[model samples]
Target chain A: MSFLLWLESTGFGTFVRESESLFAYPTFIVLHTFGLSIVVGISVVVGTRLMGLAPTIPLAPLNKLFPIMWFGFAINLFSGSGLAAAAASTTIPNPLFIAKIIFVLTAVAVMVVLQVKVFRDPEVDDKPLDTMSKALGGSLLALWLLAMISGRLITYIA
Target chain B: MNYSHIHIVLNHFPTIGTFFGLALFLYALWKKKQDMQIASFVTFMVMAVLVIPTFITGAAAEGAVSQRPGVNPALVALHQDAAIVAFTLLVLTGTFAWLALWQYRRFNAPSQWTVWTVMGLAIITMAMMMQTATLGGEISHPEIRAEGVAEVTAPPEGEEGIAYALQMWMVNNAWVWPTGETLHFTGMTLLFGVMFLVNFRLLGMLRGVPFSAIHRFLPLGILGFGVTMTSGVLMFNADFHRYVAVPTFFLKMFLVVVAGISVLYVTIFDDTWALGKGDGTALRHKIFAVTNTLLWLGAMYFGRMIPYLE
Candidate 1:
């Protein structure tokens, strides 16, 4: 608890919490918002495609989106850390915040599984999606939605 | 011109343009002219882009007139309510029209469902546009209110019927604002993702895939924009005073216009449309792609800075 309190009192944390400069908390929040959009947005498109929407879109080429998603993930990781550090004492103990982290992490794990098992398949584009792939896509979508919901609710609930 | 003047000037385009586009579309259907059909589709798409500014200016116009002695806040509210519904339908019609055009480019003809969908949406949207226009006129032009306008009771001095209720609900409910924020961010993600895919393609990132295949997903981006704009208006309505005072809000709005117009170039221009697998983009198209990406980034940046800047 003291460590968390110390983290919250650090210069970066203080800047995030109390700085009037745009580069401080505002910039972190902006990055977080942008990152969320990219990661969740691409996930939705890919998820729907797996469930058979926009079938004409060739699957292999969609590997391009993963790199972009990773870039977004990087931004989120950095910005989310800044935000968490700012409110470490309060947010670290909040169950809602923890749920958000779990949802996001699980969603990321699902994305990796899809990338390896589904997207890496040589026949991904040539054949219809199998039941397992479709189920994975559905869960990926569900998990992301949960992540978004919990993330948004963190402000209100805590 | 002031926002009121701009609103008045721009408002006619969506209403009258829809009528003209619908008429031309019907004639094109009868004549079986693909060029004419494409022309109407382009008109619908341009109007969609223009409506963003028109709606924004309408809010500014309301601010200008709402405090006047005889302005009637209730009438303003009624107009706003009608405008929201009309704006939604118009955006949907425009999206369908874009889908039709994309289908035409890809399949040599738009699918039957897409064609019928645009027609149905256009017809209904035209009617709503007219209704919105009538309500808008009644807000200031008492001469046009007519005897039948009495059906809309003047709520108390500051209260607007549905609009007032919605504003209060948004303010009072803790969940509503955060929900709006979530959806707004979701919409932003959708718009950004689509923009990233399309713009990156133009910048030569996805070289092997044909632009047409990626073009198929443009509607999703437009849908995202539609969502963002709708939720944005709701949030703005809930807190217009604070929003209007922020300089960054104006900068963000300006960037939106530039970015909105720039995206249309990618949508309708033959230069980018003709790009197939392994085809490099022309220098000019690449420049426009970079400008569009930066404009979008600027819009998001300024939007996030709205509260902090002021």
Candidate 2:
């Protein structure tokens, strides 16, 4: 925690903290949000599809969107971390803060699994997702929403 | 004077009112065994109806606030003007909600055309909401504050750096404010669309559907969160403390983090909730899902109130 605080107070942290330039800190934050939309948006769509909303839509092609989903996650990785660093650089331990970090780690892990199990075989064609697939989708959906709600809580709780 | 009063009433009323209405709707969705669906639908209708009074009273409040001392004439004007647009959007959103409910009853299950219409209206309503929210932010924060196209030009020299920085950022960023504002609005729709479905799923209103399939909508929710975070950061970069330090903003962030983590946990640890098993199988899953939705909603509502609280 002390090291985290020290890191936040460094010159880089100061830059994020004090920079008047719109591109510096604000850009990262904006990027972070965009990433959130892509990643979470994809999750919701795929998860719901797997659950059986748009049964007519093929599952395999929809899976193709996985790369973009991961890409969004990547954006969040870079931007969210930067914001966290900038934030932790100055302040003391924010417990709710720790919770957000933990959530991100979990979200990433689930996404990685999704990529491997679901989208790995590009040769696959459109078919209704199997029960296992639905389960995965349900779990994925639940994780994303939990992450989102918790993320929102950071604004108020801590 | 009238503008100020209108601003106060219009601003706070819709916000709190929306929360209540949404709460009722969610409650209805939850108790699916009962006539919760009908109750939820009714709650939404009432919410739509409330929009009218909220809009009118808001106008009166805005009239009262416009005359306050040290107020920027330009900002006051922008706030008033934007209110008309936002109010209009809210009315439209309410109407759409009513229509969507009507269609749901008529066709049973959301019809393709009805879904499209609701989606379109949601998008437009979101845009209007963003403009209204931006205007509301400007009423007090004034830092990097922009309403519509005109930049809130900086005050005379010797003005505080915070104010100057805000003005400079607002002026320098080309279309960032408007685009960011639009994205913010879109985020709300995404949040609502995905979340409501998730909520409905839990309550058994959407039982035939597998919870996993519902998971696909997670991306849309993410999209909304992304929009919010992006727009929020743009505003934050312009002025961080104004909102970040506020309790409302703080609480909102906390809820978001909770939602995010919970989603991740459920996804990876298949052990957490049995997938594809149908509803009522996993109490834990239901609790978490329901809790997550509520938190996200809370964050959004609180965020909408930042300006009013000040």
Candidate 3:
């Protein structure tokens, strides 16, 4: 606790406490919140798609929306690190902090697998759900949702 | 009695309203019921209804906050100004959405005009949501004041100096901020749209599309994630301390990570999705998709709460 207090009061901490820059602080906060929207928003579509909600649409075309999801990921990565720098000492120890890192690592891994196995397969049609594909989709959906719920809990748990 | 309180609540109303609508949409999807779909659409449209009142109330609140103690004038002003832009975008997007829905309901099949109109509205609404959220951020963080100046003096030596210098550099470089915000919005739309699609598929709504096909969208999802991450870092680099300290911030980040990991696991090890084979993976997709939806909803809940809490 003493260390936490000391860290918060240090010169670096003071700058965070006292500095005024529309771009530096506010921009990050905005981006962070905005990132959440993207992250969750895309998860809704992808997750729902896996569950068989919109049958009329093609999965490949729907994949067109992936760029946006990646965009959110990119935003959070930088924004998240910047935020971490502010209070590395405290944040490093925080349970939420550890969870976030682990989650990101796993999410990216899942994404990579998705790319290699599903998207790359030329034979697979943008047609309908089979047993295995549905299972995969369901799992992907769960990963994203868990990510979101855990994200929200960060606010309360800490 | 406090105008600020009123305005904050008013401005925030649409955001909450939109979520409620989305929730309804999710519920509809879950039940595989058309009524729920209609109800959800109606809920979403309510965003239009609340937009004007939110703006008016927000304006009033801004005026009051400027005069109050402990509130930074610059921050209040920034919030007020950005809010106006958000309000304008919301109103425009809401109108388009309403018209699209109207056209959708009245006609046997949606026309090109209506389709384009609805698409356009969705795009615009997403953009506005990004701007509105950004402005909301300014309300709390005076350090990020748009004036491109900082109150924190530079620290001496080592990590502190580097951090301070970086923060100052971010302030001095003005061009990046606007562009960053724009990119953030683009990423936001992509992410939201794709996520919606994923959720829709999981609930057994889109039976025709192969479950494997959903994986194709992952690339686009990644792209959106990229944009969001880039902009996010710029902000974080500038103000590491406050954001790190904020409780909700940590939570949101954590949830995002979890969502990402779940995506990976589903894509890799799961052997359940065999398109139209012996059986369909609908049940599995449903369960995971539902869980994903809940996680995101939780993130949204906490994200919204960040501002109101101390």
Highest TM-score model number: 1
The numbered model that scores best in DockQ is 1
Over the full model, what C-alpha lDDT does candidate 1 score relative to the true structure? 0.83
TM-score of each: 0.87, 0.43, 0.40
Clashing pairs in 1: none
lDDT of 2 by residue, B1-310 (tens): 4434444555554445444545554465456422444343344344444444444444434444557764565565555455555555554445445444544433444455644454454455556555766666667665655444345643466553433455467658765565556566556657655665555555444444555555545555655655665566456545543653456665665566455445443332344323453445457656766787677666665665565444
DockQ winner, 2 or 3: 3
lDDT of 2 at A9: 78
Question: Across all candidates, what is each one's fraction of true contacts kept?
Answer: 0.48, 0.03, 0.30
lDDT of 1 by residue, B28-107 (tens): 99999989999998888778777777777787778778788877766777788778777878878888888787777767
After the best TM-score superposition of candidate 3, give how far the Cα of residue B111 lies from its true spot, in angstroms.
Answer: 20
Q: Which ten residues in a row have the lowest lDDT in candidate 2 chain B?
A: B265-274
DockQ of 1: 0.51
> Candidate 2 — which residues are off by over 4 angstroms?
A89-93, A122-128, B1-310
Cα error of candidate 3 at position B241, Å: 28
Residue B187 shift from truth in candidate 1, angstroms = 2.5
Off-target runs (Cα >4 Å) in candidate 1 are A116-130, B112-117, B134-153, B156-160, B261-269
Give the per-residue lDDT digits (tens) of candidate 3, residues B141-231: 6665566422323333543433345557777876555555556555655565666556656665555565555544554655675576556
Give the runs in model 3 whose Cα sits over 4 Å from its true position: A1-18, B1-191, B194-310
